[model samples]
Target: MNGPGKIYNTINKCRICGADSIVDLINYGEQPLANSLKKHRDDVEQKIPLTLSFCKQSNHVQLKETVNKELLFSDYIWVTGTAASTKRFAKEFAQRVIQITNLQSHELVIEVASNDGTFLVPFKELGFSNVLGVDPAENLKTAALQNGIETITAFWNKNVSEEIIKKRGRAKVVMARNVLPHVSQIFDVVEGIRCALQDDGVAIIEFHNAGTILNELHYDSVYHEHLYYFSINSICYLFEKYSLYPFHADPSPISGGGYVLYLSATRKNKSKSLLQFMEQEESNKVNSHESWNRFAERCVEHKRLSREIIDKYYGRRVIGFGASARSSTYLNYCEFNSGNIEAVIDNNPMKQGQFTPGSSIPIISMEGGLRRKPDIIFILAWNFRHEIINLCRSKGYRGDFIVSFPFEPKVIQS
Candidate 1:
């Protein structure tokens, strides 16, 4: 899998267990990188097969192919501080971590994939001076530095972890939020987490829950960058392989819905909430093949229904709200383009002037979109539906809104 210029490779075995037990769950056909917004509408984009699969051996759900890490993350555009919701969550996350770990003010706290240092800022504000960030994006690292948070610009691996140990000693707290699923080298990253933490330190790993993905029909979250859709069982298997065991699990509001697992080198009694979470997953058969098959069927049906609803307003002015990565998957899967959508409105200025991948719809500022006098504002980022709707109304948008999720598309009168 190592090469100087290699782009991507198809996987025949499970990324976590290296077993020839991969089975296709859903194929999204050929799709572009979700975050690769184009500067020009006519610019040629690369499209690859984006399929989700399940590992019979490890019970891990992952993509059928691995896009090069550099290509996906090197010049990342997504930032954590852009959304108000994320900022609010950051404070809560910091408080929760401090309380759960009984973290000291002077102890080292390292966050992997710490985009723009938004999460780490709260720790520093809470009297923790030994906060650090590690991310692969140079541009984002610069942003983090400007925010007074020191960040190392490199991917998380055993070598990087060892270097950190030599420089600052092992961290008392290591948190990787929404990053475990994006790594193709699953074992390497987990080993890195094991090596980076102190023997008694808490390692918090947060990821999109595979159970929620199955039960909530959040197939729009499936993209090239996300290599694994991890179940709690699968994550425990990966961590326990390196002698790190989870003792607690709690729900996170990020990425629609997620789980934060607290692990340490020493084995400890599992929390009641963690046990309940696992039991519920087992009772619902979320990890079963039958559930996956049903989910795939629902995805197909949802796609059809979504397209049908959008087609009803084909000739009208339709602007998509929120140029999110998930929206990229949803819009491209629905075969939307400039003809179907006038322009996507996004708050992030980095994406406003760009065009969406595969779909080729221009991204615009909210004010620019409102100036167009659109008849319908399609809510593509349905996870923040209420917030987006309220923001639009506050900005004086009197148009109807459409939200697609949880089965079918619904239209709300202005």
Candidate 2:
């Protein structure tokens, strides 16, 4: 949503740790919605101002604007259950929580920003008497409820947190996977968690690790919706400020090129293992301005290499597969307009009739690939490359698949 000379401003200091240290890492300029690729009868387009900024003081990467909450969450289209990897991850997470915490049947396990009950279903099946999912996306919450998962369709702020605490008491285990960075007010979210969590409660928050994002040159993950890219160094500082401490952490490959952190609230002192991990992260200089510059250079290199390959293969029609949010970063950063990618293909029917947010790439059904027969299919959602390749092959679409991320541009034949 552009206007006449509208300027997006952000604090010079880190939002999480309140440090004056700051750095400019990646700038994707103005981009459209990554997953909002639907076609309306009116044929009008909606665009949002997008940019990525890094906290030099704490190494937390985030967006520069405070987008409308409604625009960010109310009618979210992305469903967590759509991806097999996510479903499997959720199942594993639930099982581990049950084992580690020795959670009884009467105990509660609540998940914030739980989309479509993907992560809550397993916990419910395990006979947890109280399983609650708090999400701002009304549409997704409705879907979760319909799927037999009990959920509250509201934003997880201090007010909602107080209500939950008053009614159901504090939660034993609160899981917020891939949600923290989307929030603009970091303090508010943490405070909400503090208010609702039991004295011994553990709040595991998994987000795209800032260290891995910079190291792997995942500039595409930088979008307006994702306000922050967290690192252990930054997150620990925030935890200390809010009385929530980092007791344990296990890095996992969940997002495309990102890592997840598991945190909790307790009076117990920081474990030696946790201290060592923090030391290692500091020694590696994951939050330095120099490291951010290197990441920016890599972003530029990726754009150049990807554009050159696509231009060379201009004779063949290019189509994008996977309507993922990360795909927006890839398309916008690389400047893939209508001329480069003919359309996008997604397995989810909800996205089939929609167009991509910023790029305006018309989203088509998986069958569109077989019918249209594009010569080069770009796997924009590169994380699921293997599964996508198999899907395409099964659908009888034989073509070179292009993967753009973590590594350079390459075309694989299947």
Best by TM-score: 1
Give candidate 1's whole-model lDDT.
0.90
Clash pairs of candidate 1? none
Identify the runs in model 2 with alpha carbons over 4 angstroms from their true place: 1-9, 19-21, 38-48, 257-260, 267-280
Superpose all Cα atoms of candidate 1 onto the true structure and report the RMSD in Å to 1 decimal: 1.4
Q: Write the per-residue lDDT of candidate 1 for residues 49-94, one digit (tens) a residue.
A: 8898988877778899799999999999999998898899999999
What would the per-residue lDDT of candidate 2 be over residues 139-258, giving only the tens digit for each residue?
Answer: 897899887888998888888889988888888888888888888776888888877888777877787777777777777787767877777877777767878777666656677644
By TM-score, how accurate is candidate 2?
A: 0.92
TM per candidate comes to 0.98, 0.92
Q: How many clashes show up in model 2?
A: 14
At residue 337, candidate 1 shows an lDDT of 92
Looking at candidate 2, the ten consecutive residues that score lowest on lDDT are 1-10
